[model samples]
Target: MMIVTTDQVAGYEIVEVKGYVKGSTIQTKHIGRDITAGLKGIVGGEIKGYNEMMTEARKLAMHRMVQEAEEKGANAIIGMRMQTSTVMSAAAEIITYGTAVVLEKIN
Candidate 1:
């Protein structure tokens, strides 16, 4: 499906607005990874482990959001956005949301 951060997609007209669609997932930090991250912090470098974890979480949330749009017969999603928050000391939540729409190519 086509997804954009803008409200409009070039050459395509939004025929129907199916409202907002959202998906979220919660993830926890691995203890081993946390230890590694702490060491990396002291050394002053990028935290690859946490970065990978959040990247995967974001992808999963986006997938679910896209699935919801597909289920509603939407061909595209506009105004796509992501939100994140820590659920606990070790866990965090990623939320993906967008406006689902039926788009038709403009002739």
Candidate 2:
């Protein structure tokens, strides 16, 4: 399915609005990785472990959002956005959301 941050697709017209669709995922920091991240932070470098974790979380959340849109027969998702917050001491929640729509090629 097509997903975009903008409201309209370049060559297609939104034919139907199918309401909001969303998906979320929660991820926790690994203890071992956290130790490594702490060391990295002290050394003043990028925390690869945390970066990888966030990247995976983003992908999972987006996948779920698209799956929900597909389930609703949406051809595309517009105005897509992502939000993240700490769920607790070690866990973070990532949410992906967008407006589901049916699109038709404009002649």
Clashing pairs in 1: none
| lDDT of each residue in 1-107, candidate 2, tens digit only | 99999998888999999889998999999998899998987898888899999999999999999999999999899999999999899999999999999999999
Clashes, model 1:
0
Q: Write the per-residue lDDT of candidate 1 for residues 3-67, one digit (tens) a residue.
A: 89999989999999998999899999998889999999899888899999999999999999999
Q: Which stretches of candidate 2 lie over 4 Å from their true place?
A: none
What's the lDDT for all of these models? Answer: 0.94, 0.95
Query: Lowest-scoring 10 consecutive residues by lDDT in candidate 1?
Result: 41-50
TM-score of each: 0.96, 0.96
Clashing pairs in 2: none
Residue 96 C-alpha lDDT in model 1: 89
Could you tell me the TM-score of candidate 2? 0.96
Q: After superposition, how far is residue 91 of candidate 2 from its true place, in Å?
A: 0.8
